[model samples]
Target: MVTLNLVIPCFNEQEVLPETTRRLLTLLDGLVANGAVDASSGIMYVDDGSHDCTWALIEAFHSRDPRVHGIKLSRNHGHQNALLAGLLSVEGDVLISLDADLQDDLAAIPRMMAEFRNGAEIVFGVRHRRDSDSFFKRVSARSYYRLLRRFGVNVLQDHADFRLMSRRVIEELRGFREVNLFLRGIVPLLGFRTAIVKYDRHARFAGESKYPLVKMIMLASDGVASFSTKPLQWSAYVGGVLALASLSFGIWALSIRLLTDRTVPGWASTVIPMYFLGGLQLLFLGVIGGYIAKIYAETKQRPRFIIERTL
Candidate 1:
């Protein structure tokens, strides 16, 4: 019998939890009845320090169904860390992650499992189209994936956290110990047999998206920095280009002075190069500082998140 575990990391999702759980239970029941998964298959909900009745609801569900289990974090760790904590806790032959808001289609799970059985270690539930998103969001998402690929960050173009992972793939993912974990980038680096299932994404049922524009930018920056050293290399290339430009200017000034027999004195030309070089220096320093900050964070060896209680 194949044991399948569904891990949901929820933050203040009281409005959507009841419906999400009910739908998920129905899916699990169907899978068991059809013998696609063992009767012991279960759902594990990780409460990421929700202030609402999210934990209370999960506890109620657990009491009613022995197949339901949960973990409560001590504080509000971000979504990625919360998911990681849940993944670390569960033991299953195959693990699936879905949002508590139910934007991702539950109907796609069985198909994802079929792909997993077809020798795919990781199955991605990719969005075929995001018609529900605004124009700005659609453009930004496309740009994000393009930029990540250019910088050598391997990532699924239209995939979020919704996916299926075989237990062996999970074991490989455990080796990545970086403090800034961009799972979308890191997962592709595992080099496992992977497949994608296209599905139309739905709008959020309730509550605004937790990922605002600022948070999305931060995630993009983290993804670029964590997966590739191309940014640092680009900084070095830009510095070299600036140096060459300055040298060319110096040569031109000297040649004009020698050939035309005139001392060319101009504040505009000299001051412009000085300002440009100064700004370039600062930019390079900032790039180096970002990497230094990441190193400092890792050196501290702090726990990702604390678990206050479990129900």
Candidate 2:
């Protein structure tokens, strides 16, 4: 049997640690006994600079159970970086990443491992349905995935960070060094044989969601910027269309004044065009600036994350 490691990123999740640990430990024991995974397999909790007793709980769990390990970041590095930190923390045959809230069904582990054993290098634990999500969340998530697909970005719909990746996959992933890392988009680009294990997304066991609307929007923007330059191309398309319209308008205006003694009203024409074109120019500039900023960040060559301690 091959070893398995669970890398969970926790951000101020003190309330859910006890239950999450209990369930994971029980599941680990069952998997070992059933020969699905080796006895040396363990769970690693990544403490993403939690300002609560989250690290304390993890240390306690580590003392109680040797299978439980922890990594404390020097500061909060967001979920994606923290997940990456966990993935690089240990050497194992199979690694799985899941959120600390336990929203990803833990019951899907056996099937995911089964798929991995059957020669699939990556197993994505996809959400078969999201009935528990709010209507706004459902709509926004659908739109996000569809928009990425339209831009030719390969990402699995209804799949978050819950998935299994082989050791080779992790090694290849380490070579991808980018300031704004989008694992969902990057993983699919690796061209591995992957399988999907469908499971229902459950409500958080405790505490509120870490990702609010603003964060979600920022994440979507990062994903788009990391994967495709379609947004920048769209700006050029808009500029071309705007230029054509302006030329046609100028011709009509000149003809009206030459053929008749009437002039296009100054405010009715100039004022509206001024505001509309100005707005479009700034919006397009912002899109261009986003890519430039990403380039700026990469040129800095700063460390992706800082680890304070580990166990």
Which predicted model would earn the best TM-score? 2
- Candidate 2 on 1-311: residue-level lDDT in tens? 79999999999999999999999999999999999999999999999999999999999999999999999999999999999999987779999999999999999999999999899999998999878888999999999999999988999999999999999999999889997988999888887899999999888999989999999999999999999999999999999999899899889989998999988875878778778989999999999999999999999988778899999
> Tens digit of lDDT per residue, candidate 1, span 1-311?
68999999999998988888888889999999988999899999999988999899999999999888899999888888899888878899999998988899888899998998789999999998978889999999999999999998889999999999999999988887777878888888888899999888887888767789999999999998888899899999988998898999999999998889787777988898899899989988998999999989889888887877765
Q: Global lDDT for candidate 2?
A: 0.93
Question: What TM-score does candidate 1 get on C-alpha atoms?
Answer: 0.95
Candidate lDDT (C-alpha), each: 0.89, 0.93
Best by lDDT: 2
Off by over 4 Å in 2: none
> If scored against the real structure, what TM-score would every candidate get?
0.95, 0.98
**Model 2 pairs whose backbones collide:** none
Model 2 scores worst on lDDT over the 10 consecutive residues at: 265-274
